[model samples]
Target: MGIRNKLDISAYFVVGPENTKGRPVAPIIRDAVDAGFTCVQIRSKTASARQLIELTGQASEVIAKTGKSDIVTLLVNDRLDVVLAAKKQGIKVDGIHVGQTDIPVDVCREYLGPDAVVGLSARTHELFEYIKNADVSLIDYFGAGPVHETTTKPDSGLDVDGKRITRSIEEITTLSRLSSIPVVVGGGVKLADIPSLARTGVAGFFVVSAISEADDPGHEAANLVKTWNSHKR
Candidate 1:
């Protein structure tokens, strides 16, 4: 079976130097995985491709040291070229996560091949349209929502009118019901929100600042995982 069939994304950690407040991305990733984060996404708006490849190599190594790399899927955010380059250099990157405007999912799947896990970013309002017309045959999962408003990616969750939008519990439940692939939610999610969000029937809870900017990322990640395990459907 491919990794997607058995991937454990219950506590998905998204991180990069940009989110780490000047700390190296690899150590924070190591801490999160050790604390029970099941998946990791390497994301950066400013890092060059070469820099990202190096970071990916570091993260891959740290995750390996934890001895749970089989269950821990590693993905690079929005940079298909970086993913390809990292793979070419023998780094253990699993796949790529792309937004609506980034590289198309079909092309990503084509290059990365069938064994890779490809994720797509789907916004709240676009769920219906995505359900109707999105070619999800190539996708492994849909990441939907800033469950609350967030500044991590300021342009995200905005409406056509440029107003900030957030996903309500009801909306999230509906999304889970309608999506063909597994759905994971993020953006402003925290420990307290885990019980309710987990009960919404979504597959996982993803986070950026919750773990990356925490005073103790490992402890915070453990708590988040603990909360999800206790309440997840």
Candidate 2:
């Protein structure tokens, strides 16, 4: 099966820098996986291509040691080159995620190949509609949110037109109904908000500070996953 098909995308999703709370990438990832996260996105706003690729290599090693490589998916944020470089180094990078100003979805799919799990971030239903109508197959899923305001990525829901669009529960519900692929909500998602967000019918939640800034990522991840699973439709 392809990486997209192999993934349980609805489970907890984690994104981070090279270090989480001063800990290295590999150990944090291992803890997250052990605690039940199914996806990890390596996001470095300032790292060079070489640095990102090295991080992927290190993270891949840690993931391999767990022997759950088949189950977990590792994606790089907005760096197609890093994904390709990691592959050249024999790191099993599953995919790439692009935003509105990054590489277009079709080009990303072309570079990464058909089996790779390409994701797009969408803050508005209009953008989501464009993706759905244009070429749904080119993308695997949508990262939909800033369900609440966030400091994690301070500019998360800003559009190309320079307007901020925070997706309401009703808006999320509408988008979920319209799209055939899974929609995972992120941004300012707290444990207490899971039950309410789950009721909107999204497939999963993406978390940054909720896990990365936690006292124990594994314990926090476990709690988030438990909350999500418990409130399923």
Model 1 residue 205 distance off true place after TM-score fit, in angstroms: 0.5
For model 2, residues 128-154, the per-residue Cα lDDT tens digits are: 666467567788888888787787687
Return the lDDT, model 2, position 225. 84
Which residue ranges in model 1 land beyond 4 Å of their true spot?
Answer: none
Clashing pairs in 1: none
Off by over 4 Å in 2: 123-125, 160-163
Alpha-carbon TM-score of each model against the true structure: 0.97, 0.92
lDDT of 1 by residue, 1-233 (tens): 76777877778999888898887778789889999998999998889999999999999999999997788999999999999999999999999999888999989999999999999996556766886578788998889898888878888798778888888999889888888878899989988899999999999999999999988988999999989999988
lDDT score of residue 189 within candidate 1? 91
Cα TM-score of candidate 2? 0.92
